[model samples]
Target: MEAEIRFGDFVREVSLRQTHISFNELAAYPKLDNKIVPINRQNEKLKVSLKDIYRILGPYTTVRFVDQVKAVIPLAIYLMFFQIFILRQGIADAALICGGLLSVMVGLMLFMEGLKLGLMPFGETIGNTLPVKSPLVVVLGISFLLGVGVTFAEPAIGALKAAGQIVSVEKAPYLYAMLNEYSGALVLMVGAGVGLAAILGTLRFVYDWSLKPLIYLSLIPVLLLTGYVGIFDPELAKIIGVAWDCGAVTTGPVTVPLVLSLGIGVASVVGRGDSSLSGFG
Candidate 1:
């Protein structure tokens, strides 16, 4: 605690970059089980009073806020500078834009916090527990449903549904229709694809299968469909963009950590061979 408090961000940055090291390899490795009291700093109790809430939250809040600020502010500043210098365009309603950016930063932080505290742990717990208790078929069925569920829950999909306004119907009828009338169907299909991918990913990890063949197999149909659409059905070619976006968002916040946790949990239980990490081949 004392070491962390002194160096703060420097300590954290160094810790984040540190690779996995065995305890035996670490310097000053403690063998004794008994607790050692530090003379330099007073020990804090596990329990905290209501008055201590601000103190407890202070460092965590700062770290989270700074993290979000790093993610959002730099790109925003670069874009604003580019607009001013390169484009020679003044930023209209700069205050409103700043407020919106701040809101986005706060929202992202809360979203991440929610994923860590509620969603991720829930997924990991299920992943860790299910393989031990349930049958293999049940675990897979759960994975499929989880993929579907996360797709439906993804905030980006809802935003994607509203992205049709910029797309001209005459130029891209199928794409326009898919985003509007057939949006639900499109989303369902994306969800199904993600669910299937999750199952395959889990199996790949456990069976120590090559990812290259899967990639080749997957790309075959996509390339064929894309080529067919681009050549024969020019009207549907515009939808390739939408299709790409759909594929992209299935890997969004709601789907990734949760599904990955579930898959990893299954793998840890049912995995074969001595492979810790699978190579590209």
Candidate 2:
């Protein structure tokens, strides 16, 4: 607080210092509240007049003519190669070319749409739901079943089928059926096992366990099995190797995108997006 006292023409003043400002003092101060100016909603004023619009659009008409001239180079090149020199004539070739391109485009569209709507969400639901299922055995069993079923439908199996056709029918016709079936079953088993592994990984993440030990332990079995396969059954060895390779490759096109997204989504929920367990194994 400050005070001033005056007697006749002489005066004396006293003042008090403050360390902090008070809200009450601030509240007493008057403030200006200016009203906002309104804006016009109607866009009646045309900045660019009709005359200017015509002038600006004039150059654009010439661009189409220039574009046609630019296209003549490729047209001339095509005429020289296929039409003049090679002399491959007919409407059939044109139809075939157009059809092939259109087919590829359609296939890609369907694949993308299917993955987005069906496979991805489905797999994610399975991953998330399975973790909370009734009993331990049931959850594990369901996970295994899902792994096998999904892997069966994977596009990479087409490669396996083709390879089986090549080796079994050509190299060893006698063991064709057995080899093919065994190859498929073994591959399916591994895929299911992989799925189970991923689930267990989710559990470990929930418990805040490190992943390195599990990864190293997994590698041990893979090495030992591969070694054993190489020694005893050479034909079976090739089949198993191809199956495992196909297990990876088969998660292709539709399956890969859907399954991977699903895996990530489920793992995210289970692990609460733990950094160590986010990626595909």
Candidate 3:
């Protein structure tokens, strides 16, 4: 026989059998106290003592450190082998290089940890919260500003600028001039491009726009400009490497996740159903 059961607003159908009956048969029945106990246990776990916290965290910390070492060690070994064995060259500032390598490893470890613990959560929170609290214009505006800000602050920009020091003034005077005299303007230009990209990316999510058309439209102007520079501006052609690098580097670790989060947040609120292109920005 089948029996219908109703409790509060919920209803379910159950079969009653004559063959056997057991406590396990009623296991699916809802228990008010059972539900509350798990929640309370979760709350208790959150309120861990320092000793308990260390015990829980100790293995994870060691694993993270080991993973970082694995990433960095191979390159270090290769460089050492090439310098000492293959090239037969004496290492200069052995102590300094060693120190620098150690520092880089430590910095990378800290940076990874910071991204996981800090930047990702912060970006996700801002992204998820901003759309609900603000208008569309406000959301786009914030995304644009964030793009510009992060692009300007990107470490790769500084590296590109430093690379300008090696350019021979006689061969590429304009390139040298742009990198050295007008570097601030160059960074601003790249920042503007990134900001525009961020705005468009956000809009794509809002409208469920296909990435294909956007990609084609963007590439047309870029290809035209590249061809024009290649044909007419020989000097500018030389610094095209730096220009491309600037564009490439603008979408670094800091900018990508933050912008993606913001895009996802806005998309979740405005769009009706999840699209294949959601959170792509």
Candidate 4:
């Protein structure tokens, strides 16, 4: 107790010797909350019936369906009119054509709605949760799996495969083979590429890395491979356009946005400087 009193007195004597004006209180933090409140979450919940759901959703669904029809039918009609009037071509398989058009409209409406309601929300939620909830390895693994799965599920990839029939086997045997015989492997490789990209991209956001250097590094190998293929390997070279084009299509309607959401989530955590701003890139 004597030593404590002596130390306190000595500290006061030293303060008296100092001339600089200063405050020792901690700076205010806006984020910190001190007041506490309790409430029942169950009481906040609202109950509704099937009739109420139908009433609320019916107009929304109808308007969406009509919007798709308006957007699709006009373009379709213009094409049909051009074919019939200018070319003097008769419509073949009218019933099939109508059915196909109807299917297209419905498919587009469902896809747009599903993307808005399902995939985007899922991606955002997963992106936000993954970094906090899982380790780096696990997050990367999921990105890989997601890339692979989305590639398979991509409407464009399937259409690309079916469109493979138009490629002349005589002119591009390897291209045909890649699209038909080795199609599964092609998709697997593409998925793997996308997955690897996702991993790198995630790391880029987390560590505040630059896209420019990475792009330059990635471009060098790709350009070299493409050039080598164009010069030395004729058969394999046939797929050069398709190969590069497929990369674009693989990024497609689904993959890029989903990847961006995840990256944004990660960036929001550890990202600094321009990383957060470019997270969606």
Candidate 5:
């Protein structure tokens, strides 16, 4: 007999090699008897100690925390030096800045860990399972929705919106309106574009289409639109930079892993291995 035990993200299989042994005989085995008795009693107690919890989670938390520190520390140091030395001005409120930076570091650590341990797995699982279990339309629908959801959820989108807050309305009323008043609609438009891109990208994976042609086709429309906006709507033309920035920011930390995981999972399942771009799709 074999038993599979799952502990958080870890799994272990235990096999009873001496299946024929009776309860009395099992008790006679010194190492097995010693370990199994305590484990069985512990299970019966049904009590979890903080130490045990820490043992299970400590390494994962420590590694993720360290990774975030390594990522954020350099930026923090650079900013501190630039503010104190180059600018010759101390931080406005040292305590507040420290608290805020600590909070950000912790939040980023948790978020990154969650992405690695949860979201990426979920995305890959859905991508791998959908094509096999659901209809093609359903898979495409899910992909489109995922794309839209990830784009809207991205942190970089908020930064783009923030950039709009300082834009002088008098200088570019239309741009300001789109960024502030019609921001929801603007986000929807960008999300829709991303969703469509995801749909086409998935289709390309399924049918083994060349990415080169798609790139050319997309560029033509983008160039023509840029020219049209530049020529016709000068007020709205001010937003051309922001509009292009939206595309870049759409593929942020949250979106890229989720979308890439989904794309790679689907491609691995349905695609021909011969294609040079099988997983790249």
Candidate 6:
């Protein structure tokens, strides 16, 4: 019986050797004991398992989302409370309280995820695809279109328009209509200006231009315009400043990431060339 057991063990070992698995292939599998651990930047050792690898990045993969929920849930809770208690609002029935809150949370997460995957990629694609034509008009037009399209969907403009109605009414009820009109016009101007800025920024990126000189150049024109407006009407000067300030605000959550990425990508491409900075300096 002992001789037979020894022979069986020898056969098992020989058979396993014949199968022949590689280190990389073994590492790719999920068995815990097979993993090689590495210490990270924080001096912490991390675990690796085939199951963990699949969980992290297989079909239907998901992110570990503590920070994501922590950030958004409180605000969602506040909105819920405001709707239920302060505003005395409710669905036609009682069940919608849960449904509404769920909808808001899901909607917000989907939107954020879409921005990360969709908008950011699109912006980078556009930056890479900019034309190499010499006259510059074609590139400017493309950038402007991108800016305008993105800005119209921005949250800031709508928020400002709503806020304007509230504040303007308190100051002068009769001027409410005028305020609304002005607010609308202001949003339009801002959207257009951002579009132009994107175009100019793209051009600078193609040229490999430095930011400081471009900023100074832009400032000179803006200062000159402000001075020109001030001489005509002091009140208008204040109004213009407020409107311009509001422009930056209007580029809220939706516009900033897209534009900033687009700007950086364009700058990178321009930097590779020998000419002036292509996009934003």
Predictions in order: lDDT: 0.75, 0.58, 0.73, 0.76, 0.78, 0.63
Give candidate 2 regions above 4 Å deviation: 1-98, 128-137, 168-184, 227-237, 271-280
Better of 1 and 4 by TM-score: 1
TM-score of each: 0.77, 0.52, 0.72, 0.69, 0.75, 0.56
> For model 4, what is the alpha-carbon lDDT of residue 168?
85
Model 3, residue pairs in steric clash: none
**Poorest 10 consecutive residues of model 6 by lDDT?**
58-67
What is candidate 2's lDDT per residue for 184-217, written digit by digit as tens? Answer: 6656665776567656655564565567888788
lDDT of 4 by residue, 1-281 (tens): 12123476465445432232222212222243356445333333344557556566655666667778999999989999999999999999999999999998888888888886688667767877888889988988887888788888887898888878888889888888889989899888988888888888777776667888889999899999999989998888888998897898887878876777667666666546553455534
Give residue 116's lDDT in candidate 3 (0 to 100): 62
Question: Model 5: which residue pairs collide?
Answer: none
- Single out the weakest 10-residue window by summed lDDT for candidate 1: 272-281
Better of 1 and 2 by TM-score: 1
What candidate 6 gets wrong by more than 4 Å, as runs, is 1-65, 73-105, 132-135, 169-178, 219-241, 271-281
Off by over 4 Å in 3: 1-58, 81-90, 271-277
Q: Name the top lDDT candidate.
A: 5
Shift in Å, residue 18, candidate 1: 23
lDDT of 6 by residue, 1-281 (tens): 12123476465445431233345643433333335644333432454678656644442222213334667679867887888899998635557656766666566667777886799768766665665433468767877887777777887667666765554555444345434766666666777888878876765555555568878987899888888987986545545646565667756778887887677556555556532223343
RMSD per prediction, one decimal?
Answer: 10.8, 21.7, 13.2, 19.1, 8.3, 17.2
After TM-score superposition, the amount by which residue 171's alpha carbon in candidate 3 deviates from its true location, in angstroms, is 2.0
Tens digit per residue, CA lDDT, model 3, 243-269: 778878877877776667666556656
Q: Which ten residues in a row have the lowest lDDT in candidate 2?
A: 9-18
Residue 42 in candidate 1 has what lDDT?
A: 47
Best model number under TM-score: 1
- Write the residue-wise lDDT of candidate 5 on 17-114 in tens digits: 12232344223323346546633332222344676556656655666677678888899999999989999997788899888888888999888878
What tens-digit string does per-residue lDDT give for candidate 1 at 89-206?
9999999999999999999999998997799768867876887888767877887888888999998899999897667887778888888888889989998988788778766765
